[model samples]
Target: MMTLYGRRGWGSVLIEAQLAYYDLPFRFEEVDDLFTSASARKALARINPLAQVPTLLLDDGRVLTESAAITLHLADLTGRDDLVPGADAPERAAFLRWLVFLVTNLYPTFTYADEPTRFVADATAAKAFRARVDDYAQSLWRMVEHAAAAPWFLGERRSALDLYIGVMTRWRPRRPWFLAEAPKLHAIAQAIDAEPAFAGTLARNFAE
Candidate 1:
């Protein structure tokens, strides 16, 4: 069994999706908003110097951080490596490309959109920063729409990239401007949410 330390955020949702996909038995330790609290900070530092949630503690006492790394590690452990492309296969290169693309391009845009003030000191500048993020997010989703082969990011099988993209797509509708710009992504999100494991998790989390 694994113990997952997570908050109710995108990273946490990705961890949950991976657990469900792998049918891995695990305990969820809620990190909550106490990430800044002294105790939470101390405990996280002891496990991961980054003091990040979505940290996984393996049964053997090893700790894993970074959602992508954790998901890939769990896939390997459960012999579900087919969810990820094999290293020698052509799809493997594409898989790595999209995985990094989601992390570097899409994820950062969401982070900036969620917390605009972090990037700018002035209130006016922060609003402008948010606007820029909104634009970037739309462009990013359009890129995803072009790259996605339909049914899944990597075609039939659900990859870690799909889980990441699904979470982000679900989040877009909450933003008024981005929601209107993301029709294709919205469809992808619906498809992901319709999956039994994902729907079950959403129902449990949001009472849907």
Candidate 2:
């Protein structure tokens, strides 16, 4: 079985959902807050220098970092296109485009804004930077909102993009903002939440 190193309710939920959706056998290794705990950072650094969550270790001991790379890797491992569109599938291009757009354009907002002091020394500067990042994240979400289709981000097909929408909607600017500003994406998130396959995973990571 694979081992996933992550903290609850972090970006690792995306990976957790997918692993569950595919019925893959994996164990979750909880890491303490990367931003606060020295030992957590030091321990994770040995496995992933970035000390980022969603760091997956295959049974063979090879480590995988970056959610996007791991997303593709999981698809390759399962050889099932359920969550990832196959190359010949028409949704392939759009899927690849938006997947990269999500990781490159939107996800970084949280990376920077979550712990702004890591990037900016001054408290005032960190606040301003976080505000800018939040504004930028909203704009990026608007772009996704426009491109979003009903039922799923890709429309009629449930892909990892839906998983991303579900988890990310819970982040900065959050579900309330998405409910009002990006109804389509919000609806997709709700749909994913209702998916029985991921019920346990989502509930565990996003417990109320």
Candidate 3:
């Protein structure tokens, strides 16, 4: 069994959704109230020196950091390589491209919205940073809306890209401008949220 160190947000929800989708048995350790806890900080540092949640400790003691990496690793373990596109398939390149795009381009947008100060300590500079992030996020999401294949990132079968996109899309309500500009992404998020696995994960971690 694997041990998952997670908190109550998207990082945790994403891992939970992947695990549930694969029916993989794992122990969940919640690191709640993360913003003010030394213990949480220390535990995360010990497991993933970067002090990040959604770290996966495999039974053999290997630690995996980054949510997408952990999810892809698990998919490989469960022989669900198709979920990420088979290694030899041409679509594999496309899969990798979008996966990296999600992590590097789309993911950071939410971070900027959540904590603008991290990018710039000065209020003036922070506002500028937020504006750039907002514009960049919108541009990327428009591309996503236009490039999306049918109902999923890769045609009909949902891939890890879909999962990542789904979580990021759910963050749009906070940015209002996102959905207003990227209606296709909004529709995609709605469809992904309605999936049983995604719904179950949300119910377990975010139910009101």
Candidate 4:
């Protein structure tokens, strides 16, 4: 069985949801907060140099990091394009486009802002940096909102993009912001949140 090292409500939840969607058998290793715990980072670094969650140790022993890589890898392993568009599928290009866009364009905002002190030496500077990043993230979401298609990011078909929206909208500007400013993306997120297949997985990871 594979082992997934992650924390609840973190980026790892994204992979956890995908694994559940694929019905893949895996054991979860709960990691401590990467931002606040020294030992947690040290422990996870042995498995993943970056000490990042959602790190997957495949049954074959190969380690996979980065959510996008894992997302594609899972689809390849399952040979089912239910969540990811197949190579020749008409939605393939759009799926890849938005997938990359989410990871590269938007995900980094959280990385920088969530721990602004890591980048900005001064506390006051960190606050300013975080505020700017938040604003920039909002602008980036606007781009996604404009490109978003009804019912799903790709329209008429659900893909990993919906999963991404579901989790990401929970961060930074959050759901309320998306609901008001990016209703299309917000609708897609709501659809994923209501998906029965992910109910148990989400509940465990997002339990209050």
lDDT tens per residue, model 4, 1-208: 9999999999998999999889999999998889999999999999899998789999999999999999999999999999999999999999999899999999999999999999999999999999999999999999999999989899899999999998999898998999999999999988988999887877887788
Q: lDDT by residue for model 3 over 124-188, one digit each (tens)?
A: 98888888887777788888777778677777767878777677765644435546876666666
Query: For residues 73-104, what per-residue lDDT tens digits would candidate 1 score against the true structure?
Result: 87778876656776676678878888878877
How does candidate 3 fare on TM-score? Answer: 0.87
- The residue pairs that clash in candidate 1, if any, are none
Against the true structure, candidate 4 has what lDDT?
0.92
After superposition, which runs of candidate 2 have C-alpha atoms over 4 Å from their true positions? none
Q: Candidate 2 on 98-132: residue-level lDDT in tens?
A: 99999998988999999999999999999999999
Decreasing TM-score order of the candidates:
2, 4, 3, 1
N/CA/C clash count, model 2 = 0
Model 4 scores worst on lDDT over the 10 consecutive residues at 197-206
> By summed lDDT, which 10 consecutive residues of candidate 1 come out lowest?
170-179
Each candidate structure's TM-score, on Cα atoms with residue i matched to residue i, is 0.84, 0.98, 0.87, 0.98
How many clashing residue pairs appear in each of the predictions shown? 0, 0, 0, 0
